[model samples]
Target: MKQKSTSPWAWVPTLYFAEGIPYVVVMTVSVIMYKRLGISNADIALYTSWLYLPWVIKFAWSPLVDILKTKRWWIVVMQLLIGAGLGGVALTIPVPDFFQYTLLFFWLLAFSSATHDIAADGFYMLDLDEHKQAYFIGIRSTFYRLAMITGQGLLIILAGFIESSTGLEPVEFSVTTQSTHTEWVVPQAKSVTTGGENQFVVTQADVVIGLNKLNKIQADSIKDWAHKQNLSNGFVIKEVQLEQAPGWWSSNVATPLKESLKERFGKEDKSAMFKGEVQGNIAAFGIRLAQMPEEGENVVLNLDRQSGAKDLSLVEGHRLTFNNQNWDQQAWVLVQADPKLDTAVSADFRGLSGNIPFAWSVTFFVLAILFVVFLIYHRFFLPRPAADKPVAESKNMLNEFVETFVSFFKKENFAIGLLFILVFRLGESQLVKLASPFLLDAREAGGLGLTTGDVGLIYGTIGIIFLTLGGIIGGYLASRNGLKYWIWWMTLAINLPNLTYVYLSYATPESMWIVACSVAVEQFGYGFGFTAYMLYLIYFSEGKSKTAHYAICSGLMALGMMIPGMISGWLQEIVGYQNFFIWVMICTIPGFLIIKFLKIDPTFGIKKQ
Candidate 1:
C-alpha cells in the first residue's frame, strides 16, 4: 500500500518537543529536585552525573536501530517505555527509599530517552526530503527549547506553588536591633507551649537583639570562632539541644567526625563568646507544631527573609521537617546583624510548610501523562515514508559498526579533535551541576539562598531567554566572520561569565532582580560561547560517515560533562563556593591553551552568497 503524504508541520514540532523533555528532567530538574529533598550536594552531583552514561554510550548502539527495526517503530516503542519510566518515578517519590527507587526509574528513563533520540533523529531524515529538512530545522529546535522552558521553568514553578499552598498557613516574625549602653547579654529561655489544633507556633513572635562595642581582643576571638563555624560577616548560630537524644547516625557517626575535627584543629574557645565593642548582634527564635501530623504526613518548615534590612541574615534553621515523632520538639532560628550597622534596623521572616514530595510526585505524574498523549498523537499522526525501513544488509551490521568507529579514529588530527572536545567545557560541566544547588542552599552555607520558585523564575525563565538571544547573536556574528576569527572571543565569552558565580558567592545579594540579572549575564555568555563548540563538532564530523561520526563526537561531549560534574560538589565543599568558582575560572585556562594548538578552516562558518 502506498503511504499517504503528511505535512512536516503535523509532527515535527511535537516530536522534537517530546525529545527535549526527558533530557531536561534528567539533567537539570533532577539536580534541583535532589537539592530540595535535602540530599547532600556531593551525593546529588555524583549520582546525577552518572545519569549521563546512557547518552554517552548511545552511539555504541546506534547500529542496532538501523539493523533490527524501522525508526518509526523504535520511536513509538521508546515513547511508551519513557512514559512507563516517568510513571515509576512518580510512584516512588513518596516512598521511604525514594532516592534509590527514583534513581532506578530515572535510569530506565535515561536509556529509553537516549534510544528515542537515536530513533527520532534517524526518522526525521527518513520522513522528510532534503528541502523540507533544511526548512523545518529551526522549527524543530524552537519546539525542543519550548520543551526545555516547560520542564525547567513552568514545571518547577508549578511544584513550588503546590509546595507553598498545600501545607498550613505561613508564620511570620520580625527581628529588631538597637544600640544599648548596658553590656549585651544573652536572653534567658522560656518554656514553649503548644498552640490550638492544626496550628504551628513559635516561641517568640518578635525579638530584639542588643548591639554594643567590645574590646579588640574579645572581638577578634569571636570573629575567629564564627569563621571556624562557616559563619561570616560576624554571624553565629547556637543550637539549644532538647533532652531527647539524636538519631543513631548523628550520635555515632556525625558526632564522632565533628569531635575529631575539633581535636585536630583546636577546642572551641568559650572565652571567645560574643563580647564585641563593634560587633554584630545575634537573636534566636524557636518554632514547633502544636499538633502531630497524621500518619504519612510530614510538615516541612522553610524560613526565608521576606523583606527587611539586607544586612540581616539567617545563620541557621532555614529548613526543618517534622512528623508525629518530633512535632513537639522546637527548632531554633538564629539571625545575625552586620557589625557595621549602628542605627535601628528590622527584618521579617516567613515560615512556610509544604509537602515537597507530593508536589514533585504531581509534577512527574503530569510529565508521564503528557508523554502518553505524545505516544497516542504520534501513533496516529506520524507519516510513513518509503525510506523509513530497516537496513537491507543486516549480515554486515557488525562489520559496519566496527568500521564506523575505526574510520572516525583514522581522521587527521583526531587526537587534537578528541582532546578539544573533552577539555573545551571543563568549567561549564562543573558549574552546570552545582548552579541550582548554589541558589537553593542556605546563606550560612555560602549560597544565594533563593527558593525553588525564585530559582525557576530567575535561572529557568529569565536565564533561558537571555541564553536564546545570545545564541542567536552568536550565530549571526560567526556566520559573518567565520569560526576562526571568533574562536577566542567565544572562548572568553563562555569562561569570563563564570565570574558572576564568584561574585554571587562573595556578595550574597538578597535582591531578586540582582540575582536574576547576574544569572542572565552568565547564561547569555554560555550560550554565545557554545556556538563555537557546536560548530567545531560539525566541522570535525565532515566525512563520508558524517552522521555516525557526529554521534561519536556527541558521546564524547557528554563524557566531558559527566566526569567533572561528578566531582564538583565534593570540590565545592572543600574550597567553598567563592574559591570553587575561582577554581572554575582556573579550569578555563586549559581550554584556552588547547586553542593555540588547534588547526581550523578560517572560512568554516561563513555563509555563502
Candidate 2:
C-alpha cells in the first residue's frame, strides 16, 4: 500500500456531516411530509414513521456490506443512489395524495445512505494516519452536525414556504341568513274586541292551509309548524317604523277625527278623505316582489278575494294582501294563516351575482399566483443547494479519523459500537421527534401555545450557534485527551439538554425570548456531548472495513432514535406534552449508565500509539 502523509482533521467534519444527513431526511422530514400532505395527524405519525425501520434494522446487513465490497465502491454507489432518490422525491412531491409511494422513495434513499455510511467510514480508515486522525476528531464531528442542521432546519423552512403558498384559486364565498320570529302583543290597536270575554271562531276550509285570513285572528305566520298554534306564542309580532310624523298629537287627533267623520257624514255622503294611524304590528308577511324584472324566469303573486263577502272592510284586511311595484325592493306579504301546519316556503328564484367584488378578487388572485410561481421556481426548478451532497474527499475533521474509524466498528467491539450508536444520538432524535405536537397543538390542549414561528426561532436560530460551539469544544476535548477521559463528561453534556424541555414543560413562560433561550442552551449541551460519540466510532472503526463497521454503528444509532420516536407520539397522545418531557428526562438515566463503559486514555486524541 502506498503511504503519504494526510491530515485527519481536514475530512472528518464534512464526512460526519454527510453521515448524519440521510438519516434525518429519511426519518424526520418524512414524518413532516405526510403531515403537510393532508394525511390525518395520526396517520402521518403512524405511516410515515415506518421509514425509520431501514435504519433501525440496518445493523444486521451492515456486516455483509463490510465483508463484500470495497469501501470506495460502496461510498460512490450509495451516493449516486441517494442522488437518484432525491430526484425522485422532487418529482413525486407534487401529489400529497400518494403518501405510500413517497415514503417508499424515502426508504430507498435511507438504504443508500446507510450503505454509504458503511462504505465512507471504511474509506476514512484506509486514508488517515493515527496522529492526524486524533487531531481532526473535532473537525469531523462539526461537519456531521452541520449536515443534521441542514436536513432538519433548511429543508423544513423550504417545505414550510412551499406549503403556505400552494393550491389557491379565484372564487367567491360568503354567508347570509334571514332571522325570523313571530309574537302577538295585545294587537296594539286599542281594544278592537273585548278582552277574553268571548272566543270568536270562523268557518274553516276543508282543513287546508289558508294564507288569506285577516279577521280570522290577524297575526304574522312566520312563527312555525302549527295550523292552530296558541296566540302570544313567544313569536315577537312587532314592527319598527323608521321615521315618524311631525307631531305626536297628530297621531292621537287622527283617531278622534275618524270617529267624528263617521258620526257627521251620512251613509251615502260623499267624502274622499279618511284619517287613521298605521298600527305597529309584525309588518305583514306576504310575497315581496322585486321592483325590477328578474334576469331569467317570471314571478307571479295571485290573490283569492272573498267571493261571497260579509265585510272585507277592515284596515288589517287590506294589509293581509300586498304586492310591491318596486322591482329592486321586494313587496312584503302580511297574509295571515293557521299557524299549526308546516308551511313549505320556496324563493322560486336563482342567481345572486356571485360575482364578488372584482377589485378584491383580482388582488387576491394575483398575490396567490405570484407566490406559487416564486416558490415553484425556487424549490424544484431553480437551484439553491443541490439537496444531496456528492461523494468526494472531505476536509472535515471526521475525514482524518477515517483510519481509526474502522477499528471502532470491528466485530470484536460490536457491543461498544452498538452502545455508542444507541446512546450518542438519543437526545437529538428524541427531542426532534417530541417537539412538533407540543408547538403545534393549541393552548387549551395543554401545550405552551407557541406559534410555528416561535418553534423555528427557539430550535433553529439560537440552538444553531450554541450546538456548534458545544460540538466543537467536545470534539476538541475528546481529541486532545482520550475517549475515557471525556466520555462521561460528554454524556453529561448531551443528556442535560433534556432538562431544558423539563424546565419548559413546568414553566409556561409568556415571553417567547425566555423560552427560546432555554431551548438553545439545551441544544448546546447535545452538540458538545455528541462529539465524543463520533470520535469513539471513528476510533473503533480504524482497522478493517472501517466504512462497514461505521455503518453498523450508524444502524444502531438509527435504532436508538427510531424506538423512542415511534412511541413518542403515543406518549404525547397519552400523557400530553408537559408530562412527556418529564418522561424524556427519566429515559436519559439509561444513557448515562452506558457511558460508564467508554474507555479513553488520557492522551487519546494526541496520539494513536
Candidate 3:
C-alpha cells in the first residue's frame, strides 16, 4: 500500500513543542514549584539536578529507539509515557509524602522525555529531505521555545495567582490590657477599623504585672514625681498602694512610703478614705488602668493577669487571691493589627490551610491532557518513514553499543575535547539552578524579592526572546567568520554576563525593567556564546561513527550541567546569593583556561565561499 503523505508543517511545531515541555518541566518548572512549595533549595537543587541523569546517559539506549520500534512509534509511545509520568507527579503532589513521591514520578518523566527527544531528532532527519530540514529547523526551534514560555511563563504565573488566593494574609497585633483577677476569657467579637474597613479580630497580646516602666503617665502628679526622680518616659508603678494613717497631715509619712504613694496615686488623695477594712500594713488594692486609646479607635484589649508580688509572675489560672503581704494585679502593652483579619478563619481540613493542591493537580493534569492531545494529533498526522533502520545498522546490538563507546575515546585529543565539553558550561549550570530561587526569594534573604509572576514575566518571557535572538545572531556570526575567531569571544560571551547576576545580587533592584534588562543581557550572552560550544561538539564528532560520538558528547554536556547544578543550591544556601553568584563568576576561569588549549581548525563550522 502506498503511504499517505503529511506536510512537515502538520506536525513539526507540535512535535518540537511536545519535546520541550517535559524537559523544561523536569528541569526548570520543578525547581520553581519546589521552591514555592517551601522545599529547601538544597533538596530542590540536589534532587531535580539528578533528573539530568536520564539525558546524560540517554546515549546508552539510543540504539534501542532505532531497533525496537519505528521512530514514529517511539515518538508516540514516549509521549504517552511522558503524559502518564506527568499525571503520576500530579497525583503524588497532594499525598502526605509528596516530596519523595513526586520526585519518583519526575524521574520517570525525565527518562521518558529524553527517549522522546532521541526518537524525535532521528525522525526529523528521516522524514524530511535536506532542503526541507534546513528550512523548517528554525520553525521547529521557535515552537520549542514557545513551549518554554508556556511552562515557565504562563504556568508559573497561574501557580502564583493560585498561591496568593489560597494563602492566608499575615496576622496583625491588636491591644493589650491588664486584668486584676485572672477571670477574663479571651474577649470575643472584638472589632477594629483598619484600611478604612471595620473588622473583628482574634487578638493575642502580652501582659506584665508588679512594676512596669511606662512612657505615658496615667496621672499628672505621678508624671511630675517621676520627672523629679529623673525618671523619664514613664514611672514604675506597683500593683498595690501605700497607706498613710487617718488624719495624718502632721504625721510625716516615711519618705520611702511617700515616693511609693505618690508614684501610685500621682499625689495622695487626702480626702479619699479607705473603703474596705485593711489588715496589718495594708493600704489599698486595685489595678490602675492604663490610659486607653481614644474612643472610636477600633481596638480590643488582651488582658494579661499576673501576681502582684515583688517577683511579677504570670497568673497560673483564671483566679488568684492576695496574701497578707501582697495584692494581685495585671498590665499589658498594645500592638497594631489588620482589621480585616477579624473575618479570616483557619481551615479545619487536612492541611489545606496554606497550599492549594487542587490548583497544582489541575495544572499538571492539564499538561498531561495536552500531551495526550499531542499524542493523538501526531499519531494521526506524523507519517512513518521508509528508512527505519538504526543510523549505524548491525546485527549485533552489543557490538554496536561497544563500538559507539570505544570510538569516542579513540578520537584524537579525545580527553581534552571531552574535558572541554564537560567543563565549558560548569558555571552556567550552577547559575541557572540557583537563578530562579534568587529571583523569587525575599529581598531580606539576599534575593530579588520578585513575585512568581514577575519572575515568569521577566526571566521566562523577556529573557527567552533575547536568548533566542542572541543565538540567531551568534549562529550568523560563527557561520561568516568561523568558530576559531569567535571561540575566545564566545567564551567571554558565555562567561561575562555572569557578572550581571552578581550585580543583581548586590543591587537587588525592585524595578522590573532593571531586572528584565539584567536577565536579558545575561541570557543573550549565553545564547551567543553557546554557539561555539555546540559547533565544537559537532566538529569533534566527525568520523565514521559520527552520530554515536555526537550522542556521547551530548551526554557529557548533560553531565557537565548536572554536577554543578546538584551542588549549587547547597552552596547558595551556605554562602548566600551575593557570594554564590560571585562563586559562579570564579568558576568561569576553568572554562576560559580550557579553551586556550583547544585545537580547532580555522575552517571548522564555516561555509566556504
Candidate 4:
C-alpha cells in the first residue's frame, strides 16, 4: 500500500473541490444571482430557495448508481451532465423568457451536482490508502472550502460587476424642462416658457368641486380650532401635473388675492374682508391616503381600505374646504382659493407599466460561465483520466462500491457507525438549507425578510468558515478522545442552541445587529457541537473502502437535509415563520432520540489513543 510520493493522495483535494462547486452554485449562488436581477426579494426567497430539492432527495437514487455503475463512472458522467446544464444556461441567456427557462436549467444542474457528490465520495475511498486519508483530511476540507469560495465569492462578484456594468435602471421620464407652468394653470394664459404653443402642463384649477358649504360638525370644529389659535383665514395652494410629463412640476395654486381685492372690493372694503374670517358657511371635502405597503421603494399606495398594510400616519378627518361660492377657482382673491396637492409622486399612477423589470446582463454572464465550464470539461478533462492510469486491480461495479462496507462492517460496529455519521452533522443537513430561506421570508409570514446579499455574506462566508473549523475540530476530538462521549454532548449542543432561532422568531429584534449576533451565536454553537460527530464518521470509515462508505454517508446526509428543507418551505409557508421555528424546536424530540440511542465512548473526543 506504500505510495510513491508525498503527493500520491492529491485526489482528495480535487474531490472536495468538485464537491463544493456544484453545491454552492446550485444551492447558494443561484439565490444571490436571482436577487440582483430585480426579482422581488420575497419571490426570490420563495422560489429560488426551493432549489435545495436536489440535495435533500438525492439519496433515493444513490443506491441505484451503487447497484449499476462504478463510482468513478458516476463522477465523470455527472460532471458532463452538469456541464451540459450550465451550457444550456449560457445559451439561453439572451433568449426570450430566459428567467423562467433558466430556473429549470439550474434544477437540472442541481441533480447532476448531487449525483456527482455521491461518486466523488465513493472514488475517494477506492483511491486512497489509510495514511493518505489521514494526511488528506485537511486537504478535503480545504479544497471544499475553496469550492464554496469560488462559487459564492468569485462567480457572484463577477455577476455583481456584470450587473453594475451593463444593467439599466432606466432613464424612465428623461426630463424635458422647456414646458411652461402658467399656461398649464390658466389654460389660455401665455406659457411659462413664454412662447411655446404646446399646452404641456395639466391644471386642476378649472375643475370646481361644486360643494362650497361646510358641514356643521367641521364648521364648528374649524371655527373653534381657528379661534383657539387666534388664526385668520389663509389658504394653502398647490397645482400638479403629476404624471405624463417630463421634468414636469406643478407649483402650488397661486391666487393673486391682493391685486384681485383691489379689483373686487375697491381698496377700502378689502382690508376688513382680508382681516376678517368667513362667518357665513364652510364646506369640507377630503381624500383619504389609505394604502399601506408592506415593502419596497417608491411604493404607490394601493389605497384600498381593506387591503394593504394599515396606514399608521393617518389622522382623523384630514380635509379641504371652500369658504364661499363667490370664490374664484381660476383667480386669486380674498373670496377665492386654489387647488393644492402635497404629495408629488409622479410615476404614472393610472396603470401597471411603471414597475417594469430592469433588463440586465447577469443572466448572460451566468450563461457564459456555464459554457466555459462545459468546454473545459469536454475538451480537456473528461478524456484525460483513462489514458493516465490503468485499472490494474478491477472489480465488479457493486463490488467496488461495497468494498469499504464489507471490510469495516465486520470489525467496526455498523449501528455505532451510522450513529456517529448521523450525530456528527446532527441537524446541519436540516439547518444549512433551511435557515437562509426562513430568514428571508416576510415578517407576516414568519421569516426575517433579509435581503439575498446579506444572507450570502452572513451564512455563506461566516457559516462556511465555522463549519470547516468545526469539521477540523471534530476530527481532532475523535483522534484525541473516543468519539462516543464527545458526540452525545456535541449533538446536544448542536440541536439545543438551534432553539435560539425559535425564540428569535417571536422576540422581534428590531435591529439588524440583534439578528446578526443571534445568528452568529447559533452558528458558532453549531460549529462547536458538530466537531465530534464528523470525526466519528471518519473513525467508522477507517479501513479499506472508508472513502466510498464515507461518500455514501455524505449522500445520506444530503438526503437528511433535503427532506427537511423540502417540507421546511411549506411548513414555514403554512405555520408562518415564528411557528415554523417553534416547530423546528419541537423536532428536537427526534434529535434527542438519535443521541440517546447511540452510545459512544465518553473519552471519544478527548484524544486519539
- TM-scores of all models? 0.63, 0.49, 0.54, 0.49
The pairs that clash in candidate 3 are 182-318, 200-342, 214-234, 215-233, 222-266
Query: Using alpha carbons, what is the TM-score of model 4?
Result: 0.49
- Give the per-residue lDDT digits (tens) of candidate 4, residues 1-609: 543432433355555676677778777776765543334456666777778777666655555455554666677677777767776766664566867877888888888888787666555544543333333454576688798778866775565444334312211111111112211121232223323221112222222212133334544564454332212322222223335543322222212433443354332322233222322122111211112222332211111111111111111111111123211121211111111111111111110111222222444345446545543543433322222221224556555545534654565457755654543443455555668776655454455656544565667667667666755655444445455646666677677777768776777666767777677767766765655444545555444444445555665655555566655554444345556566666666665676666644454334233
For model 3, what is the error of residue 448's alpha carbon versus the real structure, in angstroms, after optimal superposition? Answer: 9.0
Report how far residue 448 has shifted in candidate 4, in Å. Answer: 10
lDDT by residue (tens digit), candidate 2, 1-609:
543433444345545665687777777766655533334456666666676666666655665555543555555556556656665665555544456666667788878776776655666555554444544555665677677777776766554334323322111111111124334322221112333422111121111222222222243243232211211221112233358655765567744664564455313322112111111122222122223233542222212222221111111211111112222222222222222112322111111111112221232233224334322432332212221122223434354345334455345647755776776665556677877556544445555766444565666677778877877677566666766777888778878767877776677677777777777777788777777777777666544445556666666666677787875765455455666677677777877776666554455556565
Candidate 3 local lDDT, 424-507, one digit each (tens): 988999999988888866555677756544676877678878888877677667766777888899899999999999998888
The TM-score-based order of candidates, best leading, equals 1, 3, 2, 4
Window of ten residues with lowest summed lDDT in model 2: 346-355
- What candidate 4 gets wrong by more than 4 Å, as runs, is 1-3, 6-14, 27-81, 95-108, 126-153, 163-468, 479-485, 499-518, 535-552, 562-609
Which one is best on TM-score?
1
Candidate 3 — which residues are off by over 4 angstroms?
A: 1-12, 24-53, 84-107, 123-142, 152-365, 380-388, 391-394, 427-462, 476-488, 499-519, 538-548, 564-609
TM-score of 3: 0.54
Better of 2 and 3 by lDDT: 3
Count of backbone clashes, every candidate in sequence: 4, 76, 5, 30
- Candidates, ranked, lDDT: 1, 3, 2, 4
- TM accuracy, model 2: 0.49
Question: What lDDT does each candidate get?
Answer: 0.77, 0.50, 0.64, 0.48
